[model samples]
Target: MQARKTIIRLFTTFLQFDSDKAIGWVTDGRLRRNIVNSQVYSSEIENSENFWVTYWYKQWQDNPKSLAKEHLLAYLQETCYWVASKTVKNIYSPQYTVSDCFQMMIARTDKVLKGFKPEMGFGLKNYGSAIFSSELKELLRQEQEIDICTNWRLLRKLTQKRLTESLENIGMNSKIIERYILAWKCYQMLYTPTQRTGTRKLQKPTLQTWEAIAELYNNQRLKQLPTNTPECSPEIIEKWMVASAKAVRAYFYPSHISLNVPHGNSEASRELIDDLPGDEEKSPISQIVIQEEKLAREVQQDRIKSVLLTALEELDEESRKIIQLYYGAELSQQQIAKKLEMKQYNISRRLSKSREVLLYKLAAYCKESLHISLNPPVLDYISTLMKEWLKLKFNPPTSEMEN
Candidate 1:
């Protein structure tokens, strides 16, 4: 009977039975006898409110040899299916499977459980849930960030291809072309890959930055060259480095490049098209042009609102709660601080920072996914419109007011 009840509990865990059902079965006299007989389950079930702890303990004990090698793999698999389920839904890419999340959760949970003690007075389920959920959220956040970085890498490759083709068309010298490519590589490395938003904050690359890149490049070339070959002079290397730095600075800043002054050829214009937003080609003069333009702008405003709502989901839970209370509930910063037991200044600062982060993310999304730029003025308009939309969404008009 004890063995039969133990089998039933194992099946219940595998099938993911609801807590009440599992608890009912676990607290039954027969199941309690099985749990009492299982020495590993006795300690965990002593003060537990639910059956999950005993079930998890049983699973862990049943696979003691596997546990010795893999630690929490069996235990987490029995206990944390919900963690994998939730993580899978949040991951932006389809490439990651639920099994991948499960493996990651097991690894993270093993590390966390190493520090856990029975005397801590917290149930394993509660502690494990908190740790696993937090780690899973961070993992999902990184996956989203990686998706953004991957898109930026593709953008860089496409830009490099276009620049190469354009320079070749102009009949540029091979050495100069190499210098230009080297300069572009230096420029790319000056900023970290993850922060390469279209409207990223720009800083002028210093001479030291160029020198470091040049030294690294020279060392790599020295490694590949045969010992019999004469090394390039310091003077020649310095000259190449200077030229590469100049080319990179020009490519990124382009302060001297004039978009307003029309270049004579199609190739010049095509080069500009990829770097600058293309000007809309003129269509036949029509009487409804003004109305069409107005309608288009309205459609764009609607899209911005939709995108803002989607971006809100990316914010952390605390930030999301503040946004909901302040924007959705129409609470002031002071009122929100009071309700949340935080400083008024902190509340105000969080709201300001959250808005800025959201706008930056929104701009990046528009540039990457929609092939549109969200300039300062456009972002300002969208921010105002989003607030108004949120008000309508959350604080609907009363029936009496509607009448």
Candidate 2:
């Protein structure tokens, strides 16, 4: 049997908090208590989730200092954890961790909330899941960049302010930091990696290279720092450089937070339970509920696809060609303009206008068929979804094309 969706329980369990602790995080205790007790986080009770989301969001907007803000954030964090867990799915490495991506999603909550409109008919979790997925992709890109960079390349890329802050974070005194920075400057000036290729795999400086760097540092320290500062040995310079690289790496990587503990508390965390709320057994009713949800999702997806297909068919030939060239052929605006004998800006304008028209149709479909309200946020979200769908629909795989 398929397992019941336990997103809420998973959230609370990862938080290492019980319903009481969760309630304590909120100012409006009564509402939170009602939610926890009723377990309205299930698919059947989705409207309950929507209500609390809009209610707490309003509280936050009305008063930035409102205690209900905590509740609002916690609710959104549930969506973040859900998306992050699904995206990462136990695939951890030195470069990426679930907690790290979760942190990135949490960081984007403000931007996500700012762009969310409850009037749009989509639930907050649904909205947040899309943005969180994008943020995770960006995090992955950054991690990949850092992962591939050698220590030398990483340090070379880091700004002086970042280096200073990193050294300071490790409790280095200002004077020592200054000496380290001066040594680094001398090394940068003197030590050049002999092997120059496209790869980031720069080998460590040889002993002779380190000695040259030390000689330069010794000669320049008197000019750069306090006149009486002692000259450093090659070993000390090498040690400082290695330590600086370590500091940069430590500062760049996301801090590992324990999922089993609540934020800001050091006490022992609560343990997970075997049974989720409201569904103890694989009963026929539970199975029916799950199937209904699955069916509803399929229905909604089909409706969206139908609306998009009709809208595309109704578009003008030129607009259709523009979309096909841009999304299907994956051509740049300039390239499309060149091939079509039009100005680049004209191609850009046509693409924008085409998107707007398609988005408007989708928004109308949402109102007429899906019973969703028309709002700027809703239109923006529909635009994102429409663009993604168009890209996927237009851009079939090479093998499929060949067939």
Candidate 3:
């Protein structure tokens, strides 16, 4: 448990993956390859351009069947303890603690990475053991600062150096060591947030692409509504037809418009809502695939409109129409009331109530779209910012992280 805690802390800082969103990104293989190597016991070995001149180089033409790359890697993992023992022998320190074991890997350690190249059975000279001095470390540090944080493996040695020093200060007190390790785990958990799946700043191509997607989705939605189930009554059909119309209407006036386009709402916004599949006719068990396909389509389309429309679908058609006319069509409350043959005050009351429903929907939408858990205020801020982000490209003024 103590080890786990410290490791968690190490992961938090190393990968910045505290949230589920962060976890999803990491697990999905969307993270930097360096993290796997430097952060965890990564299996991959990256050979640089002058890889032969630096470390991890190998001389071709030797006993080729000696050690396979896969075998060598497996051996490294399986024999780290033995390696630690060998280091201890070289260093001649008993009670040296785990820090010394890692230090062995860091410096004053030498080993022949035995590996054989297949096909020709050539003898390979593996240079697995080498130490970096402070000067070398400085060079490494400079390289990291110049590079993006994606190459986190380069940062691990540095992180470990400090952590090892910190660990050494605590002496060998078991309780103290346990406490510190626990703290480390908590630290890792805290640092991890949402990971960047794609580029952060919204660009013109992305917006235009989304706009095109919205149109395609609108057609698919129209096709899907009637195909979902057996025929139903006029009342049910009316409910769906009016709700769909309202959603279409509401889509016109987005709460926040994408900034990439000089004209925010000049281009048409597509409606992408489908009437709920006939739940009454549904089997006792649900078809997850069908639902997933629908959800995936929703995600692919103008995700923003999909989110708002989803909320609009939950309310009665009358309320939905009123809300749509009020916000979507930019209709005055009095005008909406007059068109619907209702009192102006009633229109106001319904719009307010529908707004609450839509707000909840927007919150859920943000969670799905950004993979960020946000409360009302945070959701509002994110929604607003995303709209602003949409208007600009990932260039000097808008881009925060320099690629």
Candidate 4:
């Protein structure tokens, strides 16, 4: 079963649990009476009834009970309520998908029909209900958030401070070429995602901020920002250094990049559509074909990520630090080398060797798990194969598999 389908089935079962099965305590039932010594009292008694436990044990157990009755008393009432509440929530929550609805409906039909499908009607005819034909229309709607932004002035103040701090940190030592990337990191939070950028709530930044950042970068390129030996406020610089690092930190957080492959989607998608670097006048179908090919390429990249994480686990602290400081931390080769107190050349050599070893490990795992030979290890082909494997799992075969 597909994971989603299995989850739906389990959730549906929770929704439709019998009251008897869900209630964990005998006292939770409709009947409640005190069976006292020599007097079968039909009186409703609270759990505080005297020596009720000993009386129940004597009457109910065939022998000495396995569990101490005292041990269960504290939890029995609470457990029954919890179980019943959980069942109710699981069945009716909107979080339950159509697959859950299908399971519940089928189960209800089975019980009432007694070994006959609701569709078959169990040797009954003319039981058909009236059918209505209408145009497809959407009914569900709710109030939406208005497209007004908040805290505009406060946001601008933060952005100004952030830009200044970033400049102070990267002064003299920073590569001028990476100024665009620096500007992007500082204001990344400001820009809405592509899907939401069209929405009116997220205000676009004025050209002034971009122009200011560009002008500063140009001055730095012309040897005009701060000098290595300039008189400075060491305290202010330190604070800015921390702030700048934090801004960079946001870009490299694990949650940003570790998106799961969608249920009908996968992380194997590529940025191939960014440029569309081929014949521009091609048919739409050809472009789609190109996208499909791009989707296939990410499977291997995903595999590479898995292999790298495993390799990092097996390495010493120093090596693991280098791997993350290079990859997950998104530090450039020179930056990582400076952080680690190693030569840039050495960093390059280590990264190259790690890549070779890690790819070999992934190839071995592929062969072991799926019997895939992966001749010459074409990454794009591997990605395609992974997609096909996923499709095969959910798309049941029309014909029997050959033994």
Q: Which candidate has the top score in lDDT?
A: 2
- Tens digit of per-residue lDDT, candidate 4, span 1-403: 1111221121111211232222111221101111222123312221322223223232223222222222122212222223223333433345333322222222222122122111111110001000000000000010011112222222232344444444444453354314433444434444333434334344434555444544444444346433542322323333433445444333221111111112335564432112212221111123333334334434544554565467546766766566666645547889999998999998898876655555566566666754566675343333333322222333322231111
Question: Candidate 4 — number of clashing residue pairs?
Answer: 3
CA shift at 379, candidate 1, in angstroms? 41
Q: What TM-score fits each model?
A: 0.31, 0.48, 0.21, 0.21
Error (Å) of candidate 1 at residue 91 is: 8.7
lDDT at residue 8 of model 4 (Cα atoms): 15
| Local accuracy of candidate 2 as per-residue lDDT tens digits, 126-217 | 56776777777766765677678888776666678888988998899999999999988887887676776445776788889889999999
196 Cα displacement, candidate 2 (Å): 2.5
Q: What is the lDDT of candidate 3?
A: 0.34
Which regions of candidate 1 are displaced past 4 Å?
1-72, 86-100, 150-214, 217-403
Q: Give the lDDT of residue 402 in candidate 3.
A: 12
**Local accuracy by lDDT, each model:** 0.47, 0.64, 0.34, 0.33
TM-score of 1: 0.31
The residue-by-residue lDDT of candidate 1 on 1-403, one tens digit each, is 1111243343221211232111111222323333344434334333322233433333444443322212233233444555565456554456555545545565565544553332222345444654675676676664444334332243243356645654565567765666555545544665344454553333433456556656655555455544453434434544544444334333322222211224557654532212332122122123144334434544655666667777777778888889889856767888899999999999988888888777776667667755656677555544544454554456543322000
> Which candidate should be chosen as best, given TM-score against the real structure?
2
Cα miss at 81, model 3 (Å)?
A: 68
